[model samples]
Target: MSPRSCWIGSALAVVALAGCNNVSNEMVKMPPPAVTVAQPVEREIVHQLEFTGNTRATEAVDVRARVNGYLQKIDFEDGADVQAGDVLFVIEPAPFEAALDAAKAAQQKAEATLALANADLARTQPLVQRGASTEQELDVKKADVATAAADVASAKAALTQAELNLSYTQVKSPISGRVSRHMVDIGNLVQAEQTTLTRVEAFDPIHAYFAISESDVVELMAKSPGTSAASLKANPPTIYVGLTGEKGYPHEGKLDFAEAGIDPQSGTQMRRGIFPNADKLLVPGMFVRVRLPVGSPAPGLMVPDRAIGMDQSGEYVLVVNEKDTVERRSVKLGLRVNGMRVVNEGLEVGEWIVINGLQRARPGAPVKPERTTEIVEAKQLDASNDPAIANSGAQLSTTTPAKASATGGN
Candidate 1:
């Protein structure tokens, strides 16, 4: 081979190396992923706390026999409404009547003896003054009159007691409420205050008892300055309640009682709400869901519920920073209101939250964010439809501010 051919080969190899270097230095750049972002919706919303509880009768009484006698008649039907002083049972009155008659005869006899003794005393007074009768004899007559008078008084007292016993034969209801079935049948011997005849319970104005966690109580007190267990008596917050198989909290009541302190073992405090149960829907021992508004209405931020993401760290949202970079933010959530989740904490009102195209965004990655206004429509909150409550199998119920206000509260 010639020297010229070798030099040309070397030059071609250098040119090829220079071309490969130039090609590697040039880079292919791709545009950032596109995502839809929206600012948090600000609205006037009332924060609500929910709890589970049980219903109890406002007043419950166990009717018992007051006198020892054989039951002659049950005046009221089983499970009937009874008024105060209504005759519920009739004991055998024949014995009481005979005793009363005997007492009356004894009283009459005592009175006749006292009248005769008084006449003797009157006659003896004059004899004693005239010395016709011995002073000792007059004194004996006076002492006999006093003893007869005491016997008359004792007989009168016995007669009064007999009358009371006769009246007790007719057992009357002590309160106006629904009456339970008669436990003792007719001809059954009932003892005084020993046998339970039946049970009567007042259904209207039922009570709901629940426990509030200590942390929740503290949060409530912080939100409302004067709210405390003691203050509940003076300024009772309105309570909304719903029974099992019910939708939202349809029944409304007021906080009636609260324990003086929280229970250390359970970290909760006992609370009671009194609800009007005119329809008799609330029954004793019925499980119920309670919703209590913690504070007055205030401005709050909300986002679409779908925008929330969950991981081991808890619920979070994808945020697009001012530099158009994706960022992950951990957030605390509240009740679902108007198809949106309340941002209890960790999200600012002005911050942009990723509402759509979440898959296209990654933390610390550049993103092409498109600003959009989220449309939030207010609607009736249904317990069965909310996944947050339904999936957890919690008895807690929630309501929107509008529904809460329309239901009316104290």
Candidate 2:
């Protein structure tokens, strides 16, 4: 081949190889990695402190016979609900009835004597006016009438006492509550206010008693003050409560009472929460958990818990910006609510956080952003539109509180 022709052919060959390499490079190039991102949502959150407590009854009464008598009948079932004034025990009324009859007889005798005195006084008044009877005799007649009148009054008082004793024979419950087992059985002699027949405890609108440390009280006083404020008795702070076997504080109550001062020995102020027990689930002496707000509810930024990452430094989350680059943000986390975590510091509302595909997302790497909110809205729509799924979801777990209120002591 001629020299010029050979050089031209080599150049053409090099150009062909470069074109192949260019095609290979074009085929190998990839689009940015797809990632799901969500903005930090604003929610109302209250900072809270948790304390352990136990349930208590608002009122308890011990039932006893008010009149001395032999117990004739037990009227209520042991460990059963009883209303106020319900008959709990029936003491024998025969003795009381006899006493009442004797009193009535005595009153009748007094009345007959009084009537006789009045007749005599009437006769003496005419005689004295006519000067036929002496004044001294008339004075003695008046004195006798007065004595008889006093006797009638005494008899009437005795009758009232006897009636009261008779009524006391029917033992009644003092308050509406559940009665305990009988302490005194039928056929036993029961003394008035001495022998206890049974005991009862009020159930609904139960109370939970807990204690807050002196430091906690001081902190609360400076912040919300609650019932610990200057007007302590009138305004009580709000509280959340949960019993054993509960997921969280499903019950809300108010701080009803606080000790006048902190206990010297324990350095804690005894506090009580009054909760409406409409379901009758809470009973006396039950152990409970309570959450008291340290501060008022305020708007805060929140994100899904899965988006949070932990390392040697602290908790952090990956945010995808408008430039499509991932950025690691160190976050000061507060409490967990629902399935989200509150970012107390270092995160701004509307910042796009990578919710899924965390493995593929790296700091400073570009990502193809997918709006997680859209996905959630779509899921919610599906839940509302599909009757079968809606029914099934209704059968799913009931709506639970998004946040956990209890915490370890500081």
Candidate 3:
């Protein structure tokens, strides 16, 4: 019980207490693991194909001068809408008029010579018949008459040609359409069938040319009969065209032509749609989107686009198995419908997928599942909702009212 013994005992007790504290700190409890959640979703997805196409006019005609002359006047304004047979240009008619007059004068001279020959033949015919003239004299007279008749016929042909040349001075439009800028100014000498006066394009029933892959054609034809282009007229597919910035479909069209053969380089088939452009909104060479419904709708698996993630590898989605374990799955995607993606492979219907909190989830980790907010019926989701569907469903709900109410109404 001395002071040194008491200090040593106090030091040992302090060391033992410190050691126990260190052991307790080393054995501290661990925190709980993070959990991810999966969602059971139902959405209608569409498989669509997109292609780039160009707008074209159904019929484009170039206006050219058929006769040689100076352009006297342009009857139609540049870019003005015109009808077929409308006069477009007028060449200087003075030259053509002069030629026509010369032809007419020649025709009159030929007619005078023909009249003289006929008179002479009448005078000699009776003499030869009454034996008052030699046979050689009658033959000579006949020859003279035939030669005069030939000259008259030649003059008549020349006159007709001259008249036709005169009419060519006034050029007219070949098709009903908007005319392009005048290629020749006034007093510009134009040649016969050589100069391009202007251009005219038919706007209504415009053409939309688009290409589809051969595979797409085969798939489409599998569903429809008369696969050949010649036979497609009976039941051709409808086409829809939309401008670059337009929201809704502006024009509806019909499939007018399909190429007889596929393009060797692109392995695609060229098809044209005829759109009724009464307003002339669609023009040639304008870029547009051409939509053609090629096949029927079918049931397909889909997942929310938000669930899809992309990295160095490609597109992937997080899937939750029945054990509530998350797994990263690589998926092949089709078209996008609503906000969901059509799954071509790598996933099945009725499987749980992780849509929300994808960044926080990892593969092989346990998660808690919750239902998604948006759920669309399988059959209700098509290219677009058909109003007939709602009508049919409502028709099924129609029934007789209560018996008392029915009797009172009657």
lDDT of 2 by residue, 1-410 (tens): 99999999999999999988876444565776887787675545567777899998889998878889899999999999999999989999999999999999999999999999989998999999999999999998899899999999999999999999999998889999889999987899998888988999997889999999999888888887655735556777778787787755778888878878888999999988899987788989989988887766566666777889999999999987767788999999876544567688988766778888888899998777776454353234224322112231222222221221122100
The better candidate by TM-score, 1 or 3, is 3
lDDT (10s digit) by residue, model 3, range 1-410: 99999999999999999988876445765432333333333332223445678988777998888789999999988899999999999998898899989988988988898888888888988998899998888788788889888988998899888888888899999999989999999999998898999999987878888899988878767764344487778876666777898643457777778898889999999988888888888899998876665454544565667788998888988876665567898988875544556677888655666776787677887555553434443223333342112221121221122121211111
Worst 10 residues of 3 by lDDT: 401-410
Write down the lDDT of every candidate, Cα atoms only.
0.80, 0.79, 0.72
Which residue pairs come into collision in candidate 1? none
**Candidate 3: segments with Cα more than 4 A from true spot:** 1-49, 246-251, 322-324, 367-370, 375-410
Best candidate, TM-score-wise? Answer: 3
Error of 1 at 394 (Å): 29
Residues 271-359, model 1: lDDT tens digits:
89999988887888899998877766666677888789998999999988777778999999987754578888999866777888888
Prediction 1 TM-score vs. true:
0.73
Q: What TM-score goes with each of the models?
A: 0.73, 0.66, 0.78
Clashes of 2: 2
Q: Rank all candidate structures by their TM-score, best first, as comma-separated numbers.
A: 3, 1, 2
